[model samples]
Target: MQNIENKVAYITGGSKGIGFGIAKILVENGLKVAISGRNLDDLQEAQAVLGEDNLLVFQSDVINFEDEVNSVKRVIERFGKLDVVIANAGVGKFAPVDEISLDDWNAMIATNLTGVFHTLKASVEELKKSKGYYISIASLAGTNFFAGGAGYNASKFGVVGFTQAAMLDLRKHDIKCTTIMPGSVTSNFADHVPSDSDAWKIQPSDLGEMVIHLLQMNANVLPSKIEVRPSKTS
Candidate 1:
């Protein structure tokens, strides 16, 4: 396994849910992690849970390119170098195409699709310097369409395509890009509070473990895309 000690990682949407889960694992394994979210309170709460050492919390909204640029600057300023980035910020709006409001559709596209691009654009230079890894958290909805999922599906599909092309572009630089498509994760996504009933679904930490696994693989080996789900249906 590759030695991850003292490396730095920046995760967007890192204040909670899957992002927080990944941040926690990375910190435990001796990485310095900087997590960004739009909510200062959520970021603070995460800092408290994860503790101060090896963690930095910043407030950032992924939809804004300027915010992402500032976030990368802050991470580099704090940790010296950025070796990994996880674009985990996203939103979901479930409704029929005809019924989905223009505002909701725009929000999904901006946050879920364009936001990923902004993160990559802002950090690509630093990632190139580190020859790092970029991982985006997509969804199974990217490949399988379902009723009332028009907006979410479109955004996630775009993410899958975007990440694949990015992988091709970055590999020559020794940078790895991967998109993780998960099914039914037990997260506070879509405003659903996690509960015991969610035990059967994939947990945030499971994805965290996967991230570690990817990071530890041999330098020449790359799993460009991964689709993960619970072992049993919930």
Candidate 2:
């Protein structure tokens, strides 16, 4: 197993939901964490809740390459080094293929797929120095298709494929990479509010635990692609 104490981590979309959950876990595990979001208010709120001692908050949009680059730079500057980078910023829009607007499709592509690319590209150099871990929060939709999921499916599928290829590429440099594909997570993503209907679904903190487990895995082991789902249907 790897020793993860006192390491530095940067997580995109870390203001809420799964990203926030993961950031909390990292901080609890003695890892210095930098959490980024486009909303400074949300970021500040998270920082207050998480703690100021080992947490850094940044305003960033993963869809913007410069934002990603600056976020990474800020993390490195504040922490002196970065050992983990998680790309968890994403948006979802569900609609029939014919009903999906060009704008919606483009938005999903830019934020979900291209955003992960930007995050990885901006942090890859720092990761190489630390032989760190790079993780992307994809979705089960990457593999399974539903009736109203053309745009989302395309973006997630791209994320899965991109993460796998990145994993193979980074392994040679001793940098680990993985994609976490989850199903039916209870969160307010894409304007959906979590309620009792989602009790049977995966919780945001479950992903945080999964990341902690991955970080503690043996250096020789790499669970590159993980799919987590609810134990039972609701």
Candidate 3:
């Protein structure tokens, strides 16, 4: 219903799972999308799945500042303007507090929190020009802590804090910011994918549809923080 026929969106971690799912739906809704991943092979495969006409693939690491900038540059060059940006790339390594390594903690922070900063920094000007939207895919772990998830929690909680502040700062520019938190999504998260044993888990498409729903919301109102969970968790 919301017409995005010419709007351009850039989604990171889009080779598979929730990122790719959102990319697919955005394309179906007539938005031009640029999807990024670290692996060229995965990006190519995702491109094929989504059809190359409405989807562009960029192979870049979100943790790398130059690569993130180049990705935004490429999208602007191709689409002329960027109307939306989703910082959906993330990584997690679970370990008890005493067992967590510095490398693991840094990786979580870099990709989950700093990666988002890079994403917004790279695209902020275009978003200001177009009065666009920015969304970050955080996690329930951000608000609800659990053991062995300290690093992940820290990153996501930081994402929530950062995006909320950004929302305040960017509102005057007419650029919206939102943080989406989901629980137990059925993905290759921590190397676990959907299976019969996981029939009740939240599918990536569910979150994909949510992204579409958020985009279609009336411009006058902002859904700043959305918390999503499976309705019938067993």
Candidate with maximal TM-score: 1
Give the whole-model CA lDDT for all candidates, comma-separated.
0.94, 0.93, 0.91
* Model 3 residue 137 CA deviation in Å: 0.2
Q: What TM-score goes with each of the models?
A: 0.99, 0.98, 0.97
Show the lowest summed lDDT stretch of 10 residues, model 3. 190-199
RMSD of each: 0.6, 0.9, 1.1
The list of candidate 2 runs beyond 4 A from truth reads none
Give the better candidate number (1 or 2) by lDDT: 1
lDDT of 1 by residue, 39-108 (tens): 9999999999999988989999999999999999999888899999999999998999899999999999
Model 3 over residues 1-234: C-alpha lDDT tens digits? 455677899999999988988888888888999999898988989888999887789888989989889999999889899999999999989999899999999999999999999999999999999999999999999899999999999999999999999999999999999999999788877777668876687788888788888778888889999998888877
172 Cα displacement, candidate 2 (Å): 0.7
| Runs in model 3 lying further than 4 Å from the true structure | none
lDDT digits (tens) for residues 62-177 of candidate 2: 88999999999898889899999999999988899989999999999999999999999999999999999999999999999989999999999999999999998889999999
